[model samples]
Target chain A: MSLLRVENISKSFKTLQVLRDVSLEVNPGERHVIIGPNGAGKTTLFHCITNILPIDSGAVYLDGKEISKLPAHHLAHLGMSRTFQKNNLFGDLTVEENIHLALAAKKPYRYDIFSPLISRTDIRKETNDILEQWEISNRRHVKVKHLSYGEQRLLEVLLAMASNPKILLLDEPTSGMSPAETAQTSEMIQKLPRSVALVVVEHDMDVVFAIADRITVLHHGEVILSGSPDEVRNNEVVKEIYFGGGAKKHA
Target chain B: MKKLLLGVVLLIALVFAMPLVLSDFGINLATEIYIMAIFAMSLGLIMGYAGMVSLGHAGFFGIGAYTVAVIGQHVANTYLLLLLSVVISGLIALVTGAVFIRTSKFYFLMITLAFGQLLYVLFWQLKPWTGGADGMSVSAILNFGFGEIVSPNGFYYVMGIAFIIFYILLRLFVESPAGKITKGIMENEARMSALGYNVRVYKLLAYTLSGALAGLAGALYAYFNVFVSPDLSGWMFSGQVMVMVIIGGVGTLLGPALGASVFIYLQNFMSTYTERWPMVMGALLVALVLAGKGGLIHWLQHGKSLFVARKRTGEAVSQQPVKKGEAVH
Candidate 1:
């Protein structure tokens, strides 16, 4: 059964329509990859799904509960979390602090005054576990602003994991990485637990091929194709816009 | 742990020892310093932690002072008056923040300024109740059951203790995960929004809390001075709090204290001679910001450490390398 369903999602900023009639679904623990060239409204789709931007029209259901109207934080409480296309981590805070914050964000807290989170042992352990899994244990105390580019991407992924969301949205998770770093990130993505459903927007075809259980192709804010990885790889329309139309060369 | 204990002990000792070492004027100046510190901390809570710019802090202060004086005039219990004033000021902040927090930086600043000015005018226009431009005064702080807890020196200790408690509380808050989210809001609001953190709500909460603290300072000031006036609510006073935060260091807890101490001392000593004090203060503020450094407190902590070590121990180690995807600069 599908854990998340997005039906007829459309969004426009001013006169510019970003996402048009985009519908997709992710079954439980399925690794869903969204592939499109630059300006494919891929990031916009993620925004709409995560409720960062209001969709002009759409219906979103998480476990059969319509959640399209919920705000981002409320959606988080409903077990949805997202990472940005641009690596967005708290810069002044240490790596551990960032993860601790995401973990804490999971549990509800009213604007608590005077309570220090440092003393929370459970949150600390969870922060440490995510950092350890991401292989960022050594830089745990380092401020996020000072991390290397590759390391920052990993940290962003780790931050999403820290929230322990049932549905994870990752936008261009490996955009500006070196080949070696890209492989490492792919390896990390491969190791993510099967309990979490993932919707990933990636530009790298190799990484998409490596991890995606299913793929969706978007062009100009509309889903032109959705199928298994092999089907998407062979589609003529996807080839024309995405793989530079020389299907013979790639084949 | 030992160092922290020593710091606390030293602070306490200094607080208690001031009256013994200083003249009456000096004691008065110190009291003003403590009150101003509380005000500055309120600003820092929003400006530094939550990444908001507020220019109407003095409105909260004025409301607080009026609450104390108004309640003192009517009510028998000084403690109850203080509690009531704080609650009223918090409510004002909550209502204002709920609306003001929805706007962006420029709009945020403008809305807060507008609301504060409106409050200032309200106090001015409601002549009989608020005493108009002349303001209100109370004969004494009625302690009720406690019996006459009303003296400047006595209030000094009260205000001082209050400052110490609030400062420590704020420090603890800035280090917590919620505090971390606030800092995150400061650095990357868009990221926070996408990550399921409601940016505006967090900010509004910070503003309300900041205002409540500011109100606490104002209420204390009103009781200490036995006066509440329109001047307390003026935009200039809000600017003063901002200046203090800038001088102390925007984000650091001790920065506001250091900033307020210097500010209150300058005004206390220098105002005795000239009405031109405002110009001098403005010049000093401009010079400080132009230096492109954080307030004196931040410099003292980090700069002094650097000077002593001379980057000798690789002690200058920043926490981590700038994440490759997210360019630091």
Candidate 2:
């Protein structure tokens, strides 16, 4: 059975139709990527799937259960986790604190008056593991606002991972990064547990080609193509519309 | 950990010994300070941590005070009346917070202010129950089941304990995941909503919690002072709470208390020499603003040495960090 399934999802903002009859599916442990030219509504699709925006028409299901109408917070409680195109980690909190909070969201703990946060050994261990994986252990006490830009982006994704989600929704996970940082993020994405199904929206064609098991192409709020990376790269229609006739570069 | 323990011990000692330091005039001043600190703390909960700017905490404060005064005037058992007053004020807060949290920042501030002013007018116009402009007085001080609570010193101890308990409670809330979500909402509501939490419900809960605490302080004031008036609901009173919160460093748990203590002392010390006490307060506020740089709390938390280090490092970097709501895409 598909871990995540979208059925004829459509959405509009004000008078503008943003997504038109979009449908997709990710089977368990599959890595899926959605790509399109600018204004392709990749972000919109992520929003719909994550329940950030109400659909004009359609349904989203997780594990065959309808969740098209669930609120974002409830969806999170239902084990859906997502990262934004932009870094959205808590600025004032330390790196450990941010990860700890994400962990706390997953499980209830003794957060009472007079009790210390340091006493929660399980949370501390979990936070330490995430911090170690993200290579931010040395800067655990550093606030997000004080971190380097690339580090902040990594921290954002790390925070999303700390929630121990079943399915991850990442919107442009490598946005605004240097070439080195982009490569690092790609490696990190590859390093994530394969058991966690992923639905990623990305602009970098190389990154999409490098990791995505399958690609879904959207243009002007409609799916233009859906296939394997080689199939999409060789498609004459995709070349004509998005790739400038395929002369410049190839992933 | 040792330092924190020492600090708590010192605070406890100060609270216990405060009553001995007070003369008759000093006792009244100290009582007002305790009440104002609690009022400021409630405002801190919403404004500091939750990022809601409330300019009408005085309305909740007045509601609490009046509830006690009216009930105390009629009921023979003062303790029961105090308890009832706090409960009633909390109910009002629950209803008001439910409505107020639905709106955005500017709208929230304006609506709360309007509600406060409306309460003020009602307190003035309702001559029979509220005693109109003259105000109303309680028949006697409260008597809890354990013993009679009458002496100014005795009441000081009660206020002191309550402040400590609430301070600890508020600190816990700030550190909780729920509290972190509130902080997140303050940063970006759109992001928070997208993350799946009901932004409105969390904000409303925080506002209600804050209002209940403010009302608790007000109830204490009514019984201690033996009177309640429309002045409690006035815009000026709201402004005072805002000033105290700002001076103390908005989100810091201990900051509001320290700010209130300093403000009360300043008011008491300055009024002895001048009829223009308001003007002195204004000048003092201006001086504080000038010295604040970032904010009083920022200065206090970072300290002068750290500020210098931060400035040096910040200049070396020279790029402005990304602000809230700026998406990478």
Candidate 3:
């Protein structure tokens, strides 16, 4: 069975039908990349899968069990994690503090109010390990807002990874990064261990071909194609949509 | 750690030293400041950390005071009364905050203000139990096993001790993991939810904790003034505490306490000079808040930097002069 299954899910906001019967699946350890034009409802699909936006129709399942109605926060404890299209970091906190909060959220002691988190040696060690693992330990004390845009985006991914999730959803992870930063992020994505499945929404074609084990193409709020990387790259419909050959406007 | 210890030591020393230097009236005012400080600090918690700006905090404060006044008539135990004050207010906060946290920003402020007014009206109308608009005197003496604390000096010391204990408790809470999560929720609620946090729960937690503290402040005030009034629960009082939190600096625990001190001192001292004291107080608070970078705490930081700059200039006089408009560490 697929590790994450997004069954015939459709979402709408008022009159605007953002997603229409979107469906996909990810196997354990699979690198699934989602590519689409700007208005293809990629992020909306991410929201629906994570239960951030309640779907207008259909359902989502994790490990064959339906989770379409579960609260968004419950998705993390259920072995799923995600990043936003935009950097969603704790801007005022230090980088280490942000990591600490992410790690703490998954722990039973997140509700521990009497004891200071700094006194938790276990949490500190884990935070340090994750920070060092990402080579961000050197900038640990700097507040996230002070970090470069690349660093903030990197921290967003680091935080998502802190949960040791079974399936991680990254939404345009390199959206605002410089080219060098994008390459670095791609390298980081590649380096991510296979214990976790990756579902990435990326626009960079170079990064897309380099990392996508399987590719899913979305257009006009529907998946036009889902196949092997080579299959998706050679598809005429994708070529028309992406390479300016299509009669369809940039919707 | 050493700095923390020194700060505590200094606090303890000041608490002991202030009574000796102040007149009887000054001591009384200081004690009132302590009580207001607790209430203001509670508001500061939700405002600064949880990103909740409430305009109905005094409702909890009134609840605390009235709890003591109404319950003390039946229960003589002071400790039990204070505990009841905290629990009752906390539970009320839990229930009310459940509804309040659903609203954000200006709506939140308005909802809280409405809650405060509702309680204020309740107190005003509950004549037999609360003595209505005339208010009721607290007959229950605060007997802590050793002796009854009835004098101004005794109340001053007791309030000071209570304030310190609360300060430490709030400090520990802010440093706790839950507190960190609450701050994160404040910064980015959707992100927090995406990161596996029940954002509403944390917001409610902060609100409940804040309400309990405000209630305790009200209870303490009931004992200090020996009076319970509907004004305690009014929006005006809530608005006053919010101003205290804002002018003191919203984020730091000490900032609100300092803000309370300045506020209470100015109000008390100014009232004696003129009947237009509220106007003066309002003007002062507006000036302090408008000082820019954020409340009085930031101004304190600015002041410290200026002093350091002057000292550095003096030290560097014989050496190479510092570059103009150069960034200091």
Model 1 lDDT tens row, B287-327: 88887578788668877767755744454375454344332
Candidate 3 collision pairs? none
The full ranking of all candidates by DockQ, starting with the best, is 3, 1, 2
Candidate 3: stretches off by over 4 Å: A248-251, B305-329
Better of 1 and 3 by TM-score: 3
> Compared with the true structure, what per-residue lDDT tens digits does model 3 show for residues B197-315?
99888999999999999999999999999988999999888888888888789888888998899889988888889999999988887777666746888788789899988988898
Clashing residue pairs found in predicted model 2: A72-B196, A73-B196, A73-B197
* Cα lDDT of model 2 by residue, B1-329, tens digit: 34346656776787778777768677767767877888888898898878889888899889888887776666757667656766777788889888888887899899999988989999999999999999988665667766887877777777777777777677667766667667777876765664556788778878878888888888888878888889999999898888888777777767787778878888789888987887987877788878874346566667865886687667758766533322210
Question: What ranges in model 1 sit over 4 Å off?
Answer: A108-111, A243-251, B1-6, B142-152, B307-329
The lDDT of each candidate is 0.81, 0.79, 0.90
TM-score of 1: 0.92
| TM-scores of the candidates in the order shown | 0.92, 0.89, 0.95
Model 2 RMSD to the real structure?
Answer: 6.1
lDDT of 3 by residue, A195-216 (tens): 9999999999989988899999
Query: How close is chain B to the truth by TM-score, in each candidate?
Result: 0.89, 0.86, 0.92
| Sort order, TM-score high to low | 3, 1, 2
